[model samples]
Target chain A: MKARVHITLKNGVLDPQGRAIANALHSLGFDKVGDVRQGKFIEIDLKESDKAKAKSEVDQMCAKLLANTVIENYSVDLVE
Target chain B: MKSAIVVFPGSNREKDAEAALTEITGTPPVMVWHRDTELPKVDLVLVPGGFSYGDYLRCGAIAAHSPILREVKARADQGMAVLGICNGFQIITEAGLLPGVLQQNAGLKFVCRNVNLRVETSQSLFTSRYEKGQVLSIPVAHHEGNYYADEKTLDELESRDQVAFRYCAPDGSLDPSHNPNGSQRAIAGVFNRTKNVLGLMPHPENAIRELLGSTDGRGLFKAMAEALAA
Candidate 1:
């Protein structure tokens, strides 16, 4: 089984990368950058076949190692 | 007072912290490995800088889950004075011991240079020696020391005067030119909600000795030592 994780900065935390991207877009004449916040996407291949277990384990990974919960939030997706 | 320094696999600044502590306090700090579940009995705990776990996921993502951090958090909750420097700051944030987060530098480049940080408040154990709002030059080297918080949180920090140090230019006033990471409001250091713990991007241990180019950093550690003694 495979698991995909998407992590993003929690709401109200400053996103310098997102701001830079917006500034760059404006500089390139794309003035209307409604919003942008950079985030991380991770894909992991595990040996377990149980989707629920995979989710639990992967969520634990997010809480323990994968995502920085103080400033970031994470969501997990299971892919068979 | 006994002290411990957390040594994550990729942390390079642990020794610097040890040296600083030994130089001032005359006692060497115990090196606490990440895998270990225990920290030495100590009144103070330090999380030093460097690429902990090679900063693989984020500045401090991996090290925050180490077994020892569980104990560190416990001790911190019990009122032990905890200080996180540089990547150490990242780890503290990752562990939810501090506020907001350290984000990538606004320029998207790793910044390594001497920066002047004005002491915003000297009431805490970490900055008791410096006069309030006095600017002192210290060295900062990091990729993700850009401090960020929302408007409401920022206002709270301001209202409570929780901001500890801020980026400053030589003239002793806040300046954007000296903002190495484009941090929100040019924040360099901050204390926890209780003001007992501190996390900062710059390395004060690196500046304590005059031979290292500035003795400004010595007063900070010295102040903490006196506070510890008292």
Candidate 2:
């Protein structure tokens, strides 16, 4: 099984990295960008075969180490 | 006085913290590795700075889960003195020993400069020298030091005198002109409910020596020594 975790800063929290990316994009001539929020996309290979169990385990992983709940939120998707 | 300085693989400031302790106590501190499960009995614990575990995922997040922190937490809960400096502050937050969170600098830049800090409360074991509103020049070097918390929590911290330190301008008044990280309400350092545990974004260890251009940070250590000796 495999899992993907999408971690992003929660809304209303200032995202400096996102702001820097937006600035770079604007300077690169892509002015259509109104706002940009950069986030982490992590893929992990797991030995667990149960999709349900994998989702829960990955959620725990995100909560424990992958994301800071105070400033960011994380979700996990599992695939066989 | 026996003190132990926790050392993770990437903790470059461990020696500096130890040196500061040895200079004051006239004895070197025990350097506890992150993998250790037990902490030797000590009067103080210093979680110094550096990119622990490469700052993976988030700053201080990985190191917070390190094995030794379990012991640190247990002792801290018993009213032990704990000081988390710079990246160590991130660990303290991630470990749930303190309120609020430290995020990326609002300027999106790694700030490295001497900043003026106000001693909001000198009643703690960590900061007992400065009078309330007294300003001290200390250096701040960090990327994720923008402190954030909900309004209710901020109100609670303020009402409890837990707001220990604030960044100030040269004239000794709050100003955003030099709020390096854009920390909420210009907060630079804060204390837990009991005030035994302190987590601050600025590096007081860096300011302890005379060659660093200021000895304003020595009072923090001296105060701790006096508290422990009492």
Candidate 3:
């Protein structure tokens, strides 16, 4: 099984990197961009054959290491 | 006072912290490696600054989960004095020993320079040598030092007098212009609920000597030695 996790800054958290990206896009004449936010994507390979078990384990990994719950949120997708 | 300095693989400030503590306490501090599971008996634990684990994943994230941090957390919970400087501050916060997360700087650039800090309280072991409202010049070097927390937590920290220091002008006034990293309410440092643990973004260890351009950082180490000796 393979697990994919997406970690994003929580709503209302200040993201300077996202803001800078937005500004650079604006300078490049992409005027439609609005309020960009940045995040992290992590992929993991798990030997667990059970989908339920892999999901639970990946969830724990996100909670403990992948995401800082105070300022970021994480979601996991499992594929077998 | 007997002290220990936690050394992470990428930590660059342990030597400075060791020198500061040794000068003030008249004894060298134990340098505990990150993988150590047990800490020798010591009155204080100092977490120095640097790009621990190369700031991979997040600042201080990997180092926070290192083996020795478990021991540090255990000792801190038992009322041992813990001081986290710069990256150390991020580590303790990431380990849940302190509230709030240190995000990237608002300017999105690494800031490395001297800044003025106003002592917010003189009641804690970390700031006992300085008077409330006194200004001290300290150097801060970090890319992620902007502190953030929920409003309720911030209010609680304020109500309990947990704010130990705040960025300020040389004359001791709070303003966004003086805040180098855009920390909430200009907080440069804070104390844990029990006041035994302190985490701050400035490198007081680097400012311990007059030749270093300022002797302001000596007060923090002196305060720790005095309070722990009592």
TM-score of each: 0.88, 0.96, 0.99
Per-model tally of clashing residue pairs: 0, 0, 0
What is the TM-score (0 to 1) of candidate 1?
0.88
Give residue B189's lDDT in candidate 2 (0 to 100): 86
Candidates 1 and 2 compared by DockQ, better number: 2
Off by over 4 Å in 1: A8-38, A46-60, A69-73
Report per-candidate DockQ. 0.58, 0.82, 0.97
**Which candidate number has the best DockQ?**
3
Taking the tens digit of each residue's C-alpha lDDT, what string does model 2 give over B128-201? 86788888888888889999997888899999999989988887888899789989999988899999899998
lDDT of 1 by residue, B56-174 (tens): 88888778778898899998998998999999999988888887788889788998889999899988888988999788989999989899877788788878878999998887788
Best-performing candidate as measured by lDDT: 3
- In CAPRI terms, model 3 is classed as high
User: In model 1, what is the error at residue A33, expressed in angstroms?
Assistant: 10
- Superposed on the true interface residues, model 2 gives a C-alpha RMSD in angstroms of 1.1
Residue B212, candidate 1: Cα error in Å is 1.6
Candidate 1 clashes between residue pairs 3 or more apart in a chain or in different chains: none
lDDT values of the candidates?
Answer: 0.87, 0.88, 0.93
